[model samples]
Target: MNRRVLVPAAVLLSSLSFPLTITGASVALPDLTGDLNASPTAAQWVVTGYNLCFAAFLAFGGSLADLLGRRRLYAVGVSAFLLGSAWCAVAGDVGGLVAARLVAGVGAAIATATGQSSLASAFDGAARARVFGALGTVLGIGLAFGPTVSGFLVDLAGWRAVFWVPAVLAGLALLLCPALPPGRGSGQRVDWAGGALFTFGLGALIWVFVEAPVLGVAHPAVLAVVVAAVAGVAGFVRVERRAAAPMFDLALLGDRAFLGYALVAAAMMGLLVPLLVYLPSYFIDVVGVDPARAGLWMLVLTVPSVLLPGVGAALAKRSPRLLSTGAVLLASVGVVGLVGIGPDGAPWPALLLTGVGVGLTTGVVDGLALSSVPADRVGAAAGLFNTARLTAETVALAAAGSALTLLGGGQPDSGFTDALRVVVVVLGCAGVAAGLGAHALLRRVGR
Candidate 1:
């Protein structure tokens, strides 16, 4: 009805749709792969392509939103997402599906960057915190229930329903796009060189990780790509330092609290999200569970994500260091315990603990990260932080899929369980290290 209601509604709707699509699509993967006769890598691409493009382009999207106008970018993004979803719904093969997903990922990147910056610009002080908390809760709802809802959809309506649902939501958000504020973009020349270098480098890195297992790490091509990726990323940093209007503010990482929040976000993505993406498939292919039941079983792992962000927000205000460190440590511990579960063993106990830790940290980090930066650079801050998080998600997801495939000898059976255990152990160890690093940084900042 008004700017206030329309803005939040549009942003929140977009937020809800993104995670819904992510979780739902993961649940849809097994069915989709079976129907299309896709190879393991192709099936993984259905998710990885989307995340790779999203992570690679987020910096550009954020800078574009700041320069062109957030509302305009938001509209363009939603439109692209709608188009991509429609294409995905009609895709006839894995190649087509992965292509469509890449489009959707780009759109998602733009939508998220613009949507978050728009919200940050619209609210301040306590109101800003509360709105962000609500954002987290909504994200949790989408994530928590996505698998169960998608499982039923896959059973009743087929995996196509997953893409269709997001398309519909994107259309609704588009209708309310006019209510979004026309943000004042600094009319500066965009740093296209920096953007290109970052995208190329990040894309190269992810491709290497995804392909490494399939093509042994010693392969000449993989080695070449690794060298090129390093050079590209290193080149990006150098370009940014000299650019008149850089896409990202490299200096943001200089803030101890900001860096701390970022590490926490990275740990959340790198450690926890892979389980969400891969476990449903494990339940169905290995544990002999139906899709619907697998989705419901996921609730043990997701319910906390839905319930704990509010508590996390409260904790963040009083003791940010504890929240950052405790959240990661708790999840890491759960994951370590998870390594002991057999194929037939109960998973709920470990999942419950992981859920608590993930839930506690959910949406809280975004708000905390943004609050540390200057208001004028909110768009860049939001973009850069999310780039870090999604990059972690993309890399970790790819690595996990690669590990599963290699260890299982391309089968999702008992070998799959063993691989999953190994993967969990590695994630748990890394998460603990990240948690401690985050704690030290936040403590130094007295946050």
Candidate 2:
């Protein structure tokens, strides 16, 4: 294959595996609980473990790619992911599976952190925009089909089959590794101290978000984690400012346009990811659909995602600010549409709206973030952009889950409906606020 086709194909394949693991694993959770005799907490970790590690190590992975050669790191990451997947497939208990997932998440972090930058290195100008759009298309397809595929796999082969899917994808990605253009490491030495502080800070922060809903935000343990996370983040900022080669370029934050684009990415993820994670359950438990059928229902949110990336790419060429503002506003309308969802409610309209909003904004915003940074620093910039997006997703999930628990009042039916309404309303407001904020920020930058 041509290097142009080969590199992006490999990166897209690797990128596709991450979301597949996320959505497919969620579908497998009930089966895992039964097979492993796991508690709700343990099952939750099956999802959280991967996300936590992925978020924590993302910047490290990107920095490493910049320092260690993107192709080499990409290969290493895929091999690790394949090994972790095989481990998960064979694990006998939830604890073992969770542990395996942590390993897989590390690999995912490395792969994802480098995936876009690799594309950036490979293509530029109109070609870059199209490739980025194509990358977005891959993401949407993975998310759209993940559940349905996992559902069939689980029904046919069992939950372990879900693990095997990513394993196979990783193996194929590894085969393409040699085709990637040679990547040179940045000559700068690794900032180990800065990396450690940032990792621990982000890790603690994510932990608090993941645990707060279960433990109560005011609980001593949660409070302690919060303080530690805060201190670690503050210390990390101090360390980065003083360090010769910081993991993140603190200087980039000064560019209001860059910051605005980053915020748009983060905010879009905050609204979209939680819905993807939770809506399948709503379809099953609330709408009384079987798991397999619920997967089909999820298409309402995911299908639009697959169809709109090209539109977003086209819009980006004309005006990214317009793309960001319009998409967010449209997504807010979708969220509002979701406010009254129930057993008899037709969710497809709201789902389509939300999906279109997210799909239209993501690629354009991602392109903006990448293009705003220096070429050599693309890896680091990708890490920072993704970190912010994932953090927002983690926090949104925690907050939404907590709201559900509080509003549900222990009643499975009515309580869940009430909780869903509350969460939808909040997400809607957030979408509007993010749209307006991005618009205002971009205007300020223009001024």
Candidate 3:
């Protein structure tokens, strides 16, 4: 097969595995929660742990790809993911599954980081946009069908099958790995200190949020961890400023268009991801639907995401700022509309609207973001932009999970609905602010 076909096939297949695991895990969470008798916090960690590792390791993974080789990193990542998934399939308890997920997340971070970098290395201009659009569409395919597939798997084979499926997908992706170009890296110094500080800092923040609901925020242990988290972040900033080669280009934040793209990317995921994570529970518990039916209802949201990225990319060519701002605003409005949902209320309209808004930013943001910067900074931009996205996703998941646990531990009651309302309103308001902020910055592009 042609290298062209092989490279994308490898990347896209691996991309499919990540979101499949992510969304499928959400569908399987209830089953796992019951089977293992895990606490709400512990159960949330099954998902959060994976995201935390993914977010934390992304910059480092990108750096390793640049230092070692994209193909090598990609191969290593996929292997680790396969192993992690296999471990998850056999895990007997929540702790074991969370540990395995963390390992898989690290591998996912490496593969995804290298996937974007490999594309950036191989393509330029319009071609790059198209490939990324294709990438986003594949991601949508994973997110779109993950739940339905997991539902069937769980119904027939059990929750463990969800993990097994991704493991098999990872194995298939590995076969096409050799088709990737093992291009020489630029030999940039890897910022070990910055990576550690950033990863630990974010992990601490998530820990605080997850535990605060159960253990009082004023608890001595929580207070100490909070202080440590703050210090870790501060230390990361300081190290990045002083490092000969920082993991992130701090100066990139000064670029208005780049900043706009980053904000849009973060907001897009913040609004969409929580729904992907928690909506299954809402359907099964609050709406009294079975897991399979809940997955079908999720199609209203995930289907638009699967279909809209290419459209968004094409529209972006005409007016990027318009697309970015409008898509975010649309999503924000859709989220606000979700506050009125009840067991009796029709959720399709609002979910579809939200999906459309979030979908439009899928491939568009990454392409716009990378193009906004100088060619030399494309790698750093990729790291920072993806880091921003995954960070937002992790934080949002933690916040939403904490809120739900606090409200009713996802009990099929009014409390869960009330908590859901609070989450959506906050997310909606914040998304609106981010959209307007991105628009303002994008409009001031030349200034």
TM-score for candidate 3, residues paired by index? 0.95
For model 2, the stretches where C-alpha displacement exceeds 4 angstroms are 1-6, 115-133, 182-187, 316-319, 373-380, 405-412, 444-447
Q: What C-alpha lDDT values do all the predictions have?
A: 0.86, 0.80, 0.88
lDDT (Cα, tens digit) per residue for candidate 2, span 417-445: 87888889899899899889888878844
Model 1 ranges with Cα > 4 A deviation? 121-130, 373-379
Candidate 3 residue lDDT tens string, 1-447: 877777888888889999989988998888888999988889989989999999999889888887899989989999999999999999998999999999999999899888877876777789886787688778878989888888888888988999999999899999988888896777877999999999999999999989999998899989999999999999999999999989999889999999999999999899988988888878877787777877888888888777787788788888899999999999999998899888764467889889999888777788789999998988778778889989998999899899888886666688888989898989999999999999899995532
Worst 10 residues of 1 by lDDT: 340-349
TM-score of each: 0.94, 0.90, 0.95
The 10-residue segment of model 2 with minimum total lDDT is 403-412
Q: Which scores greater on lDDT, model 1 or model 2?
A: 1
RMSD of each: 2.0, 2.8, 2.0
Estimate candidate 1's RMSD in Å. Answer: 2.0
**Model 3 score (lDDT):** 0.88
Error of 2 at 238 (Å): 1.2
